[model samples]
Target: MKGMFNQFGGQFVPENLKNALDELEKEFNTAVNDVSFIKEYEYYLKYYVGRPNPLYYAENISKDLGGAKIYLKREDLNHTGAHKINNAIGQVLLAKRMGKNKVIAETGAGQHGVATATVAAKFGMKCKIFMGAEDIRHQSLNVKKMKLLGAEVVSVTTGTMTLNDAVSEAIKYWVDNVNDTFYIIGSAVGPHPYPTIVKRFQRIIGDETKIQIMEAEGRMPDYIIAPVGGGSNAIGMFAPFIGDENIKLIGVEAAGLGLKTGKHAATITMKQKGVIHGMYSYVLQDKEGNIKDAYSISSGLDYPGVGPEHAFLDETNNAQYVSVTDMEALDAFLYLTKKEGIVPALESAHAVAYTKKLAHTLQKDKIIVVNMSGRGDKDMDTVLKYLE
Candidate 1:
C-alpha cells in the first residue's frame, strides 16, 4: 500500500534493485524535509531553472474562439526550454546528496535528456542519456544539445526503437550499475519511489499556478488542461488542484492517426490494467497481455502505458482524460504559433488541441488554463516534413 495508487503502482522490479530503491527513497525523504536542502533546491529553481515563468492570458485566441478566456502556463520559457528541468535539477541534486558522481536517464522528444544533461553539466556529474534510435532521428537537435552539454548519448535500437524501449534499456543499465549510478526518471511513471519522487519535484508547476492564478483571476480557474504521456506534466499541473472540486481538470492524450485505427497513445482511454516498465497501470496490451507498440507523431506521447496515478485518476474520475488526433495536434501547433506568437512542443499541442475544442463551446465568462509544456524549436524539422 505504500507504493500503490489503489492497486496501480508497486515495486514490480527484480529482487536485486529493491535495496537501492529503498536507499534512494530514504535519502529523498530526508532531503525534502531538510531546511538547508530545500533552500538549495529553491535557490537553483529560481536562478538556474527560472521558476514562476508566466501565466499569460492568450487574449487573441480567447477573443477569436469567442468563448472562454484562455491562459497559457509558460513552462516553455523555463531554461532548457521545458518543464523537464524542474525534476531534472531536483533529482540531480538528490544524486549529489547521495554522493553519486554519475546520472542516467531515458528520454523521448529529447527534452528530458537535454534537461538532464544540462543539470549534470552544471553539477559536474557524468551523464548517460539513453534514447530510442527513432527518437534520436526525429529529435536530432536535442540529441546534439545533450552531447554539447557533455552527456554520452546511448542509442537503443530495441523494440519499436521508441520511448518504451529506451526506458527498458535505461533500466537495464541502472540494474547493472545500481551501486554507483543515480537514475533520473523523466516522468511520473516507473516503480513506487520513482513516481512519488518525480511528482514531489514536479509539483512545483501546480503549486506555483495556485498562487499565480489567485493573484491574477482573484479565484480558481474554471478549468486546466495538459497533455499526459507518461503523465509527468499533466500530473504536475493537476496534482495541486485535485481536491478543489470547483475547478475542472482535463488530461489530453495523443490519438495518433485515430483511436479507431489502433495507432494512438491514448493509454487510459484504450488500454487495460497491466504492468509496464515496473508499474501497474493502463497499458496497451492484448488479451494475452502483450504490450503493443504505441504510435504518435509527437515522440513524447509515444508510450504504451499511462502512469499509475493517471490510471487511478481515470478510474475514479478525479480528472477527465480525453484524446486528440495527431492531425489535430499539428493544427493546434500551428494555430498557437500564429495566434499567440508562441510555439508549443508537439506534446503540449495535444492539450492545446483539446483546449481549443472545449473553449469554443464554452461561454465567454469562463476561464481555462493550458500548460504549454515546451518550445517548438526542436520540432521544426518534423513540422517542415509535414508541410512538405
Candidate 2:
C-alpha cells in the first residue's frame, strides 16, 4: 500500500523491519505531539545543536551575479558543521525514549555518521556507522571524526561501494538487532515515517529561514534552492514554503558529467519509479530493475534514488528538479569560497552552481535563498585530489 507523500512512500521492506517501522512510527507520532517531548527536543537543539543559525544575505555573490539578491541559510554553522546534526539529534532522542541504548546509521560522506556519533556520545548510547569503502577513502576526515566521537565504523564493500550500499548494510544490521538498536536514517528517504520524521526535524531550517527572511526583507523569497541526494536538506528547507504559491522550490541533483554521459545521480530528472531503500521513488536502474551505479565528485550526492517526497513533489509540479555537472559544482565551490569567504560542502555547491545560472536570469530585486547544507572542511581531501 502506498503510504504518505501521495502514493510514494510505504514499508516496502521485510516483514520484520516492517514491525520495527510500525513501532517507530507510533513512537514518533506520540513523541512529536507531546509537549514535553517537543520542549526537550527544542532544548537540545538550542543548547547542544544550536538552532536558529542565520539567514545570511550574500551581497557580494548577489552583486556579482547582477540579479536576484541571494540569501544563504547558514546550516553550516551548526555544531557538527551540517544540517545532518538536526536529524541526528532528533532520531537519537527518539531512540532514547524508546529504550534503545544503541543506534545504527548509514552515511556516504560521513557527516551523518559523525552527527550520529556525536549525539550517541552526548546521550551515552552506543553507535555504529555503516559507510562504503570508497566513501571512507574520500571522506577520511569525517570518518576519523566519527571514530573519535566513539562510534564503530563498518565498511561495506558491497554494491558500488557508496551510499546505496551503505544503506543496504545498515538496514540488514538493524533488522538483526531490531530489539536493542535504533536506525537513525540520515535523510528524508526510506519508509513512510522516516521521511516524515526527518522532514519534521529538518523543517527547522526553513522555519527559521522564513522568520529571518521576513525580518530582513519583509517578505518571502522568490526561490529556495538546495542540493538533493536522498533529499533531506532540500525537503527540510522546502517543507515550510510548500503552501506559498508564489515561491518556487528547486532541488539540484548531481550530474557527474552530462546527462548523456550515463554516470550521474539525477534520479528525479532521468530515472523511473521504483522501490529503493524500502521506499517507492525515482531510481536509476537497468532494464531488469537492478540499481545502477551513480557517480559524482561529491560522495554525498551520488545516490541512485531520490526521496519519495521529492518524487511526489516533482510529479505534482510543486517543485522543480535540475542537474549540475561535477565541473560546474567545483567551479561554484571556488566561486563561493572566493566571493563569500564561505566554503560549502560539495553537495551544497551543486545548488550554488544552479543558483549562479538562475540568479542571472532573474531581476535584481527578486530574492533567492540557498540552503548551504554543510561546511567544506570535511571535503578537503576529495576537493584537493580533484584539484591536483
Candidate 3:
C-alpha cells in the first residue's frame, strides 16, 4: 500500500525534527494496531465521535440524473458535525497518552479548529488554534465556539493572512513550546507522520463505506468522489481502496471561477511541483515558484497547495482530479439541500457537483459514493447570500 504512494509520502524535515517524526510514526503505528488503542478508539468512535454514519442511497438525485446510482457516505452526521472530529479525537487521545498537556492547531474553515477545541475540552487539555486573519473573519463563529470551549484563537496576520500563514505561525509556536505542546494538523497535507496519521484517522470513512456498500448493494462502489482541501477526506476515502485497482477515485478541487480565470484553488489541476510547509508538494505558485493566493467558495479548500500524497497519486495515475467552479458548487449545495433534505457544506458540495457531472457520463447501473465531508451549518450565511 505504501509503495503506491511513492516519494510523495516520505518524511521531509531537518535532522533535528527526525527524532520527533520517528516518535510520531511509532505512536501512529501503535495506535493503529494495538488492541488497547483499538478498544479506546472504538469507544470514542461509538460514544464520543459517532462512527458508521449512514450510507444513504440518494435515489432521488440518481434518478434525476438518469445515469449512475448515487449514495452518500454521511460523514456530516458525525459528532461535532464533520469528519474532522474523527482525527481530532484520535490524535487527542494519543497526545494524552504521550503526556502532552497542550494542543495546538491551524484551521482554515474553522472546522478542524473547532474539532480540536472540542476534543481538548473533553480531555481537559489546554488548547490554542492559529487561524489566518482572513479566515478568522469568515469563520468567526468557529472562533467564538473555540473561545467558549476554552481555547485561544490566535489570528495570524502574516503573508496573505490565510491557511498557510496560520500553519506557519503554528509551526513557530510548536518549535518554541515543543515539550508541552502537540501540534495537531487539521488534514493530511503536512509532512511525514501527519499525512500518515491523519489519513489513518480518516480512513474509517472508507472502511465503513466498503462494508455498507457490500451489505446495501452486494458490491463495492464503481467510483468514489470526495472534495480535496488538504486532501484528508479524499485520501482517506481512497486509501482503503488504493490496492483494489478497480475502484475509481476522483478528487474534486475548488475552482472559484475557472482554472484559467486565475482565481481558483485547483492546486493539483493547475499548479506545479514546489515545496511548502516542510514538504515537497504541488503548490499553486507563479512561474518563479512563489506560492500564490488561492480562492474558493469553500474556505476549507482555499489552500494554495495540496498534499504530497495526492501529488504522487495524480502523477502515478492511481487517482484522477478535477475542478468545480463556485457557481456549480453552490448550485449543488442547494440541489442537495432542497432535493435530498441534506444541507451539505460548500466544501462537500464540490464533490457533489463533480459527482453530478460524472453521473451523467456513467451507466445507470453503476454505483457512485460521494463523501459528504461536512455540514452546511458553518456556511449557511455565505450560501444564503449567494442564493439572494
Candidate 4:
C-alpha cells in the first residue's frame, strides 16, 4: 500500500527499516482479508474490548445549548477507557499471528501505552512502551498502570520530551530490533503501513456510529466531530462517513496557550506540507523547516505532525480542521462534568468545546456526534493541577 491515499502516504524510512516495513505491509494486507483472521479479531473485540460501545444523547448539554442536539459516541466506555485499545488489540493479534513474541509502542497521555500493555499481557508477550519524560510526569497514574501490567516503560528525554520525541525513539528502537518485535503505533501518524493499519482497526468507530446514529435519529448526523492528536480517533470516526458528502467531518486540534502564542498543536490549521515521522503531512515547523515542539495541555495532542490521511482530507476539502484553546477545552471539560456527569479526556474536551461553539449556530433539529475518545480518569492529575 505504498503511495496509497493518493500519494499522501509512502514509506520514507531509512534503508535498514524498509524491508521490515514491507514485510509488515504484506502481512497486514493478508491478515485483513483473511476470513478466519477477521473472525478472531472480531471475537476479541466483542468479548475482550467490549464492542458496540454506547451512543448516548447528551440531553442536558443539548438543552443548555438550545440548538443542535449532541450525541456522544462513548469510546470512553471501552475496556481500556479509550479508543486506542481498538488498534492495539488488532496489532497485538497480528503480532501473535506473525509469530512475534514481543510488542513495542510509543505513547503520550498514557492511554495508548496502557492499552498496549493490557493486550500484551493478555497475549503473554513482552511489552515495552516509550513515553516522553514530561508526559510520564503528568500522567503518573498511567505509568503505574503500565508497570502493573508488567510492561517496561522507558522515559524518553529527547527533543521537547513529548509525543514526537517518543515516536522518534520508538522508531529508532524498531529499526534496531525488527526481527522478533512488533511496533504498535498508537495513532494514525506514521509510515505507510502503520497509518493504514491503525486506521483500518479504528474505523470500527465510524462503522458503529453510523448504525447507532441512524437507529437513534432515523437519519445520519449532519456533522461528525472528533479531536485530532495523531489523528487516530478523528480518522476512525470520519472514515466510514467520508463518502457521504452531506455529512460534514470536523477535526479539532489543541491550541495550547492560544494559536497566536506559538505554543499550539493546531497542525492542519497552522502548518504546511512536510514530512515528519516518516510520512508527508501537515507539520509544525520553524522558518528553517525544522519541526517545532508542539505544546498542548492535553498530552495526547502535543505532536508536531498530523496523520497523512488527515492532510489528504484537508487538501481535498473532505473535512474541515479547526482548533480549541487550553482554556476552552478546560471549560468544556468542566461543563460536561457539571451538565452531563461525564468528565472527558482533555483531548476529547477539544471536540466538546467545538461542539458547544457549533451547536449554538445551527438549528435545534440538526444533530452532531462527538467521538468521546477517552474518559478523564487519566487526566485527573493534570486537571487538578491546572484547576488549582
- lDDT per residue for candidate 2 within 1-388, as digits (tens), equals 7366787888789888888888998999999999999999999999998888989999999999999999999999999999999999899989999999999999998889999999999999999999999999999999999999999999999988999999999999988999999999999999878999999999999999999999999999999999999999999999999967899999999999888989899999985888899998899988898888988889989899988999999999999999999999999999999999999999999999999999999998899999999999988877788789
List, in order, the clash count of every candidate structure.
Answer: 0, 0, 0, 0
Off by over 4 Å in 3: 1-4
TM-score of each: 0.99, 0.99, 0.96, 0.99
In candidate 2, which residue pairs get closer than 3 Å at backbone N, Cα or C atoms, i.e. clash? none
TM-score of model number 2 = 0.99
Stretch of 10 with least lDDT, candidate 4:
1-10
Root-mean-square deviation of every model: 0.8, 0.9, 1.8, 0.9
Compared with the true structure, what per-residue lDDT tens digits does model 1 show for residues 243-299? 688888999999999988989999999859888899999999867889999999999
Instruction: Give the lowest summed-lDDT range of ten residues in model 2.
Output: 1-10
Model 1 misplaced stretches (Cα beyond 4 Å): none
Candidate 4 structure quality by residue, lDDT tens digits, 1-388: 4755775777789988888888888999999999999999999989999999999999999999999999999999999899999999999989998999999999999999999999999999999999999999999999999999999999999888889999999999998899989999999988888998999999999999999998999999999999998999999999899968989999999989998899999999985778888998889999999999999999999998999999889888999999999999999999999999999999999999999999989999999999999999989988888889
Error of 3 at 211 (Å): 0.3
Please provide, for model 3 over 68-109, each residue's C-alpha lDDT reduced to its tens digit, 9 standing for 90 to 100. Answer: 999999999988888899889889988987889999999999
Q: Model 1, residue 13: displacement in angstroms?
A: 0.3
Query: Where does candidate 4 stray beyond 4 Å?
Result: none
RMSD after Cα superposition, model 4: 0.9
